[model samples]
Target chain A: MKILVCIKQVPDMESRFKANSQGVWFEETDLAFRMNEYDEYAVEQAVQLKEQLGDAPEVTVLSIGPDRVVEAIKKALAMGCDRGVHVQDPAAATRDPWQIASIIASHAGDKGYDLILTGMQSQDRGSAQVGVTVAEELGYACATTLVGFAFSDGTVTAKRELEGGIKGVVRLRTPALVTCQLGLNVPRYPTLPNIMKAKKKEIQTIAVAELLKEEPLATTVSFHPPARKGGGIVLEGDVGVLVDQLLGILKDKTAVLR
Target chain B: MKALLIGEYRQGKLLDSTFELFGFAAQLGGETAFLLVGDETRLPACDGPLYLAEAAECGEYNPDLHKQLILQAVARENPDFIVFVHSSYGWDLAPRVAARLKAAQVSEVIGLTDGGFEVGCCNAKMRRTVKPSTARAVLTIQAGAFPARQPNGTPRIQRLAATGNGGLEFVGYEPAEAKDVDLTRAEVIVSAGRGVGKKENVPVIAALARALGGELGASRPVVDAGWIEHSHQVGTTGQTVSPRLYVACGISGAIQHLAGMKKSDFIVAINKDKDAPIGEIADVLVVADVMQFVPALTARLQR
Candidate 1:
């Protein structure tokens, strides 16, 4: 079985993000980057699926971004993916979901992969729309935020996350897409052997111009940074003193005792 | 201008985020119509005209079929704006709808501005105000960002053609076998994050919850670590809660965690780092070690 796992390198979530001095977008330069947390689950799931399948399940990890974003594709390679595809697009940083998915679908749709996997949402955009769009663009069935899935014959049984902790199971035929959520599987750290091998794996680079249509479907009108919350009163003191103050306030003004 | 709000339902009941779309339509300030594409069933109440489409496979969410049903509805209605909740369902369907319509989308929107809306970006470390370029645009509004517009009275409903089921099939949900505590109804939530340090330390936090006479809640990391039950997870992808008081212990308040509990009436965040984002909404920020503070607070409350 062949699988395609989509990964993205996003600015470190722990870093202090600052808006671009002139625009609404974040200052991308000088920020640390990592593979999206959710996609880590996707990569891990792909690896596990390969292990379960017994054969060297030809797993290819794909990413779209500037040249720097190839690091994420390599990270997936280090995690045991067979190869990598970097759809080089510098503008991917600000491109809308439709555009990005369209570019990916063009390549992935014709590739005849048995399955396509991606993170439910990106840590940066957090749109959770790209995988679904890519599925639609590819004329394939798709599921989102799936926590549990199993492959059998030509169909897959999947468990989905709904609001309020409800889990639902669904069946979809092969050539399907799934956007993975957290808790699906613990992503493994790349071992020394795998990390060395990752440096040797071939990453095929494709230009965005060859895949994108003449005009993007969507365009951003303008961007401005959102207002920060006026952090409320911050109490200062020792841990015990702070607890005393919090308890007094909770007891008097809130429902701590109630 | 006419704005169409697509409603998503599971097991014959509309999701809570469905109503929140009404708030988006209201904010758009125009003829707001609620659209539901599924089996031939009655739709949830709407303040504006409700458009219903009965489809063969509309029982559950089939991204392929649902997008087609929405496209038909959009073509018939020619709405200026098509709105959806930024829930999993919306995230699954909206972009395809936008792609088919050849329209633009502004997703994960948190606030409405004069010309457009604001979306959280960079892990909610910052927000970006965006205006769509398309005359007819699509949107996925963030959950809990906008209040649901209460249904005024009997909504004027209209039915559309039945769209057939697509390549996908609907399989019923397997509710987590665990008898999970629903946090939505909790009066007070004493929530813990990874800062509690270890699995053995969870009970101290639980003791604080018990002392407060409240339910125990946990962030995604703690629950994923098996430090707490998955049912106790309170975050964007978990159970959303709006308790009267939310005591956050050691949680740095990631956007996902905030998405679940920010609606609480009063927030008390106890984190070792004072610079955590939870302090923004926190009624009182107690900067201290959670391991030390939770026990002290529990003792004080019990005393």
Candidate 2:
């Protein structure tokens, strides 16, 4: 069996973000980057499935970005993927989800992979659209926000998390796609030895232009920090006094309690 | 402009969020229509052309079958905008429909501006206005972002037939396991986030909740860390609660988490970082260590 896992490198969630000079996306120079938290679960799942299949399956990890994305692919390799593919596109950050998904579908359409995995959404765009678009582009069965996954006899059973804490169960035949969500599994840290080994692994680089099949349908008109509403009063002084004041306000004004 | 609102049906009925699309349609100033893969029983009472693909014919939510119906509806209606409620169903199907239509697609729209649709970016610390270059576009509005427009007249029903067989099988839904805790019903919610330190420290926040005669809630990080059960999660992916009073302890207020609880009557946030986004919406921002302050607050309340 063959499997493909798509990973994205996102700026750390806690970083101070600013719009780039182009006013299209966050400035990249000052931000620290790492594999998206959700995609880490996808890579971990792919690696686990390979291990479960006992050396029978080959896992290929793919990423799209400037050269920095090679690091993300390496992390997936360190976590036990067989190889890496990097679609080099300096303008990757500016491309909409449709353009990105079309690039991926065009590249992976004929790869003959039985299963494809991706994070539910990127930490940056958080659109949660690429995997499903890729599935539609490739005409594969698709499921999103998956927390549990099991595979046997050319079929996949995926557990999807819906709103209001409900779980939907779905079964899909092979040549399917699933998006990994948080709590799917604990992503493993790459051991020192594995990191060194992963450095030696082959990463095939392809210019994104060769795979591009669609223009961006959507474009960001402008980006800025969220507007601040009037600031709230800050409670100060002794902790005990703060509590009393808060309780009194809650009781007298909001009437949440007596 | 003409817009098609993709209605969602699940758990045996039409979702209430479906009506909010009409509100968005009104904002966009367009002639609106509706489409649903379920039968007439799930149709919304609205004044528009409603396209119905009965489950008996189309097998609702079978991606290919539903996509075919939507494509047919679009071909006939020629809508400029396709709107969906940014729920799980929308998250899955909107992109597929958009890809097939070769149309622009935007997800998680939180607000409408004269320039364009506003969406959260950079982990919700920033916002961006996006506009579609294409004449047609697909959009998924954030849950609860728009008010629901009341239905005054019945829709003109137009039935559609399914024509495709997809590779996925819809399995039964496993409802959230019955937990004694229901955050929605709680009058007060004292929520814990990563700052609670560890699993052992959860009881400290729970103690505060108990002392206040309220229920304990948690942010996505705490729940994802397995420090608390998923049932207690307060976020876009979890439970949306509007308690009378909300106490956010150590929660930095990610956009999704804020969406879940911002409607509370009164909110008090305790975090060491006064500039945390939670402070923006909080009625009172208390800058202090949650570990030290929560225990004292609980002790005072209990006394």
Candidate 3:
């Protein structure tokens, strides 16, 4: 079976993000970059599925971004993906979900892959819409937040996480979309040998304009930072004094009926 | 312009967020319509035109079936805006409906204005830009992002007939049991995080909660560690709470975690590290060991 996995590069979650003077987003220059936390799980799941097939399944890592994104693709290759497709478009960074999904769909549309995998959502956007939208664009059955999966006889049965501990298990045919959740599997780090081999793997770059002929559907208005919080007062002294102070604060805020 | 508000009801009563959405819709000034899909006995009362999609096995949420039902409603009502709460069901189902209708979606919105809306989005990345906007917008209102409002008296309720396309089938459903204490409505909440050390120390926080007659909550880390259920989690990835008094213990307050409980009336954070982000927002910051403070505070409260 052939598998295609989608990956993205995002600002490290630990970075203290700030807007530049132009009122545009720019991570602190001192910050670091890494593969999105969730996409690692997607790549791990893809590699495991290949192992289950009893042979080296042709795993392709597909990423859409600027030149910097090839680093993320190479990381996936080091994790044992067969090859990489890096769609290089300088303007791709500003593309909305529709445009990004369209580009990915265009590549995977004719690839004749049996299964397509993606992280439930990118760490940066957290929109959680790309995988499902791509599935719709490709007319494939799709499931998100999938925590469990079992494959047999050209059919895939997967368990999805729902609200309040509720789980939904569905069966779908081959050529379906599955977004990997956190607990799906522990992703393997790149070994030195694999890392060296990945450098030799071919990376095919596709331009965004070449891939997407239609104009994007949406435009961002502005980004606003969340309001800053006030400083806190440290309460000292014995437990009785603390309780009295705490209760005093609460009583002023809420009307205690009793 | 009119807007359609979709709500989910269990066992006949409207979910709490439904009332909040209705209040929000009233401010936007539109011909608001409410759509409820469930068993006949479980239909909720609505203030606007109510479209009832009844099925024998509709007690559980089936997205495929819901897509068909919502598509029919969109075609019939053709509202300018489609809104749903950012609940688990809404998050799961709204995108599919939006995709089917080819509508632009904006999830996790905090407020609505006449011109557009102010949303709390992770993708906005703490900066504003006009290149990423879209029309036919579908937005999911974040819990606790807006203040809840009382229902308007005498909302007109019009009953519509049930319709089905029969393309999707309901296999089965397992209802999630309701919790005894609804943290979202609790005025005082005592929350624990990974810093509390082990699952065995949870009772210490519970003891403190008992003293203050408050609910017990958890951050996503503790919830994911299996120390507490996901329902008890407070964060962007978990449930959002807006209590009058929120006590966060040992939580460093990641942006995702802060997004959930930042609306609390008074936040008190107790962590060893003084620089924990929770300390910045907390009204009271206790720089000490949670293990040492929790039990002492519990003792004082019991007195």
The model with the greatest TM-score is 2
What does candidate 1's lDDT look like per residue over A98-189, in tens digits? 77888888888678998999999898888787898888778777888888989888787889887666777778898899999888888999
- TM-score, every prediction: 0.89, 0.93, 0.77
Candidate 2 overall Cα lDDT vs. reference? Answer: 0.88
User: Candidate 2, residues A1-258: lDDT per residue as tens digits?
Assistant: 999999999998767788889987888988899999899999999998988888789999999999999989999999999999999999998999998998899989889999999999998899999999999889889999998999889999999988767888989998999999888888999999999999999999999989997888999989988787875778877888888887777777676566
Off by over 4 Å in 1: A219-225, A228-231, A236-241, A255-258, B38-49, B55-57, B151-157, B180-188, B197-204, B207-215, B235-245, B254-256, B259-265, B272-275, B288-303
lDDT of 3 by residue, A156-181 (tens): 77777654445666677777888877
lDDT of 3 by residue, B109-188 (tens): 66654435665443333423332244566666766566656555444444444343222223344454355557888887
Query: What clash pairs does model 2 have?
Result: none
Candidate 1: residue B42 lDDT (0-100): 51
DockQ score for model 2: 0.66
Worst-scoring 10-residue span by lDDT in model 3 chain B: B164-173
TM-score of 2: 0.93
Tens digit of per-residue lDDT, candidate 2, span B97-216: 998888888899988898889998766777899998989999999887789886677899999887756778888888876756789999999999987889999999999999888899
Whose TM-score is higher: candidate 2's or candidate 3's? Answer: 2
Candidate 2 C-alpha error for residue B55, in Å: 2.0
The TM-score between candidate 1 and the true structure equals 0.89
Better candidate by lDDT, 1 or 3: 1
